[model samples]
Target: MYDTILVPTDGSTVAEHAVDHAIDLAETYDATVHALYVVDTSAVDIGLGTEQVDRIRQGKFGDMPELEQRARDATGAVATKAADCGLDVTEAVVGGQPHGQIADYADDHDVDLIVMGSAGRSGVRRALLGSVAERTLRTTRRPVLVVDAETGTGSD
Candidate 1:
């Protein structure tokens, strides 16, 4: 019953698991996979793209280019994997609130399902209760499938 699936990647190992699950779902349903990588502006220091030190010292402000490149790399990897699975894939790099961006993207693209990791790159203690995943579940109108990186158990 799924025509479009979304998978958000932050270049984390947990996210990699999510990618695998998403790809499998796409293959089964013949759905198009959208790989989105968001550059978390909130995590950046001083509201700038640069690190905390650069923001503190006011020395530079060009870290955004590097961050964008990193985001592209992350998305590209997802796209590559999805393509290798013989699934239709669309990939993009965005900067904004992670949960908001993901939810908005789902709405804008009419995504049927979202597959995500239970934990983040920093390794959260709770699965499906992590900040982004929880917020996404609260915000999105579509169904969310959260896969535990350690256990590989998925709950929707």
Candidate 2:
């Protein structure tokens, strides 16, 4: 029933765990996977891309080198994994609040499902820091499959 799937990755080990699920689903349904990386401009301490840090310091920016690397690394990892499964994949990078960006991407891209980790590298800090998966689940209309990194249970 799914034609398109969205997997939001932060290049974390936890997020990587979810990539398998997204790929498996794509393989099962003959769906295309979209890997998205959102550079959280809210937590920028330094600019990665060559540009005015002061200018980006005031607003959302995804062109920073550090964030760009994270995006490339995250999306690249997804692409590799999906490729191994013989699944079609696309990658994108954007800047915004994590949950909002994910939700917006799902809506704008006609995503059939969202596959993501239950938590990122933040770990237990999630209780205090909140979760991108949780937020995206709350904000998006698409069905979300949250893979548990520790247990690796999401499929079926």
Query: Stretches of candidate 2 above 4 Å error?
Result: 45-63, 120-127
**Candidates' TM-scores?**
0.82, 0.82
In candidate 2, how many Å is residue 47 off? 8.4
1-156 in candidate 1: lDDT tens per residue? 999999999888888999999999999999999998866656665534345434323322254567667777888899998899898999876656789989998999999999998663355555434678888999998999998888777887
Writing each residue's lDDT as its tens digit, candidate 2 over 79-110 gives 99898888889998776688998999899999
lDDT of 2 at 4: 97
Q: Candidate 2: deviation at residue 34, Å? A: 0.3
